[model samples]
Target: MNTNLSNDNEFENDAESRIETEVSSEVESTPEESGAEENLIEENISTSETAVSPTSAEITTPIEDNEAAGEVKEVKTASAATSNNQGMSAMAKGLAVIAVILAIGAGLVFWKMKVGTHGESLNRVTAEDMQIILKDANPMQLKALAESPEQKKKISENIAQLLAVASQARKDGLADEPIVKQELENIRAVVTASIYDQEINKDKGPMPQFGYISEDQVKEFWNDTSHEAEFQKFIDSKLTLARESGKFPKDKELTEEELKQAKDDFAKIMIYAEEAKEKGRDLGEDFNREVELQVKLQQAQFLAGRYAQKVLADKVKVTDEDVAKYIAEHPEYDTKEKKAKAEQILSRAKAGEDFAKLANEFSQDPGNKSPSGELQGGIYKDVPKGQMMPAFEQAALALESGQIADNLVETPYGYHIIKLEKKGEGKDANGQPTQTYDVRHILITTTVKDPTNPMGREIPVTESVKAKLAEEKQKQVLDEIVANNPVEVAEDFTVPQPSQEDLQQMQQQMQQQMPSRMQPPPAGDIEPPNSQEPKKPQPRQ
Candidate 1:
């Protein structure tokens, strides 16, 4: 039996050895399968080693794998949540900024449109103010305002009335009329032009070089001129009656001082009168014929003055009784006549004797020579009341007829050596007596040179120089303005042109309004309207 058991054991050992050999051969033949099997074995080994227990090992392997997978999924979800939150926050901020900008922009646009649309309604004006504003407006601007037919009709009706009222206002001394003001300006321009010519032109008179000239030349010129001689003769004739009546000194050659005064007075009158004449002539030329109208206007003025004088003539008569009555009424005009009388030492004055010395040497009055020499004239006539200084009037009043003032009288004009002549009376329009007197005058004068034309030659400026300078300056200013400013013109533009359709319509309308013959023929027709017939369209070739 022992022998039989030994044999069975040997057979089992042999079977186990054969099984091992078979497994080794299979691994060598299939390498990929071997590697996969080995990896599975390693995982199983690791799982087994980390297992808390045999059952735990089996459960933890799959549980741990599932936990790792769940953790990765949770991380991805958190990251996505954070990214979405950040995107939403940025969107909210963007929306807020857009809202604020839109609000401001909308408000500005609304305000601008409101102001622009209501500009005229916010500022109202009245009729008087409108008239004043429109008076000086250009024709185009006025036409724009009165665009409608009704407004234009109202303007036309009021314009004539307004002009008439404006004229009346001017006559009453108001100076607001544009037309009147323009006329006055034109007159002034003419006067200025005349003055320029007189000053610059050498042929008009004795051209002044510098300072003043004495009256000797003036007297000589006057005596040589026939017109002036005639005027002098007329003046002398008027004065002859006064001399014969012992009312004035005898006729004699005027002294150098007297001649000088007369020349100065004449020069002033001539200058002003010539200026007036020139201005009048300019106006006349712009209106009626030049010289004739100006002369007629002067004659009209003279006639008007004569008429006024005649109307007031009865009021200005004088008589001896009236003079006596005046003297009785005013004690100042009546005083004891001075017995002192002496010849004037005029020769001594001209012979280099001091004026004061000669005045004192002539011993006609008790007054000092200083005051006497300073006095300008011996008598005053045709002077308004209260014109003389109080002291001067008092001194003069104290003197009697034919009596000189004891002391020279100082007045605003100058110093005066007064002699009380005969007192007289005049009558007004009512024939009531008034104070009057006949007086005569002697004058001396001096002349002064014009500085603008020292050489007394005319300086002529040509039109070319004025035009060139004006054009250059204008171009310079225009270039500067254009350089500093930028302007844009619209892309699509065209000069206005009449359309063929418009011309045809206009012609048709004209034909409809007129008889066939009265209507205008075709544009190029040279034949008379009565001789022409309407041409028919020719057939196309």
Candidate 2:
């Protein structure tokens, strides 16, 4: 197998090129040769159980834990999710980024084994073998990706690449580690059960051969006292982690129905796993290696998430007192005084003064100012209806072109003196008719600018302070982890840096590959005072 990791786009293009070349060549083959190839592919369909894709595993849903409260939730400050004051939680974003990094590292191993051409010739693994691997790796995508010889050849090569890394892991004694061994077993059980679920769920006839788990089975599992205790311990640990990571509410508790459902789920998993073992699937070296590679990747993600959560809770905790101190120190962020200043600015604007000039001189919104402190006159052109704060947009929309709002508009940020410079009709991105406007505003901000952030959004004083502290703590924690576990790559291990275009393409691929739950939330219309304008895709709700 050739060992080279190229950009994902390159990978796809190469595969397509190969498929086209193979299809053209096959057109000239004899009828006997074609029939044999078809039979080969069909025969390998049963071996799909050994398929694997290191980067394709979805995040496991966390079962509720019932442990007592920990110190992590004490002093209850704002969530780290809102640390950036952006709609998306910063902590969740960080976790997703870490997941991406871990996935990439796992991918690096497989990519190292990727041969530029069809790898079957080198390994003596035919196209049918590759088909089975691809089918099992992504059962949902099997028909579309594995029907053709060239497709199977390329996709199977990917699965084969992962085997090399898993083999290396076994040779290095990694597979023998206690934690790894346990995790591998758990993963195998879950995957085996999932495959069984798919098989039984197939619409074979009016009456299926395999029926759903009965209530008796669920009860039987729960009736075991030891099983109940084990489940409790497992759930408690999961709940504790969920609460600490802010993924669940502090008071989250399990209910009878939920417990019963969990038992039923586990019963199915265990039964299917046992069945698979009895059928000799567990003894397959290829299947074991595929699972080993997945386990390795999953373990890395779990450790990183746990370590980052601990660092945030233990070392970078932010309290309300910290925010209060920051608010008190920054007099410019005083709400009462800022409100008064906004009224003054409103009066000046209504008194026939140059609105842009007043905005340039008085608006506290840093987005309207240049790095050299040059005023931009607070002008926002081609603004969408739903893109500004409710009060700000309401006041702007109520006025006619060349008119200003009669009263100062108040929002969480502070006060806005809005002037409608232009109002017009336009088609939105979806080609639907929508209202677009150009507006100018002078803002008197109640919040302070984040000194450490380049975009300079008007985050609350407390959030700014917390963000700073958390950032410092994260840096410290990461530094210590690196120092303790030193690593140096071999001189022969070098990967060429991707170009900017490659990076953008890679980002798109990652976004597509990322689970829907982990993706960032949509942007809200109510943008902060100093942040960039919101996108104009919809009208104000």
* Cα lDDT tens digits for candidate 2, 328-417: 886765687767778887888899999999987887665565445556677766654554555567788899999998998765456778
Error of 2 at 13 (Å): 32
Candidate 1 C-alpha lDDT tens digits along 164-247 = 222222333333333223322322222232233333343544343211324564455466566365334323432342232222
TM-scores of all candidate predictions against the true structure: 0.16, 0.39
- What lDDT score is found at residue 127 in candidate 2? 36
What C-alpha lDDT do the candidate models reach, one value each? 0.27, 0.42
Candidate 2 clashes between residue pairs 3 or more apart in a chain or in different chains: 2-114, 2-115, 65-235, 65-239, 81-89
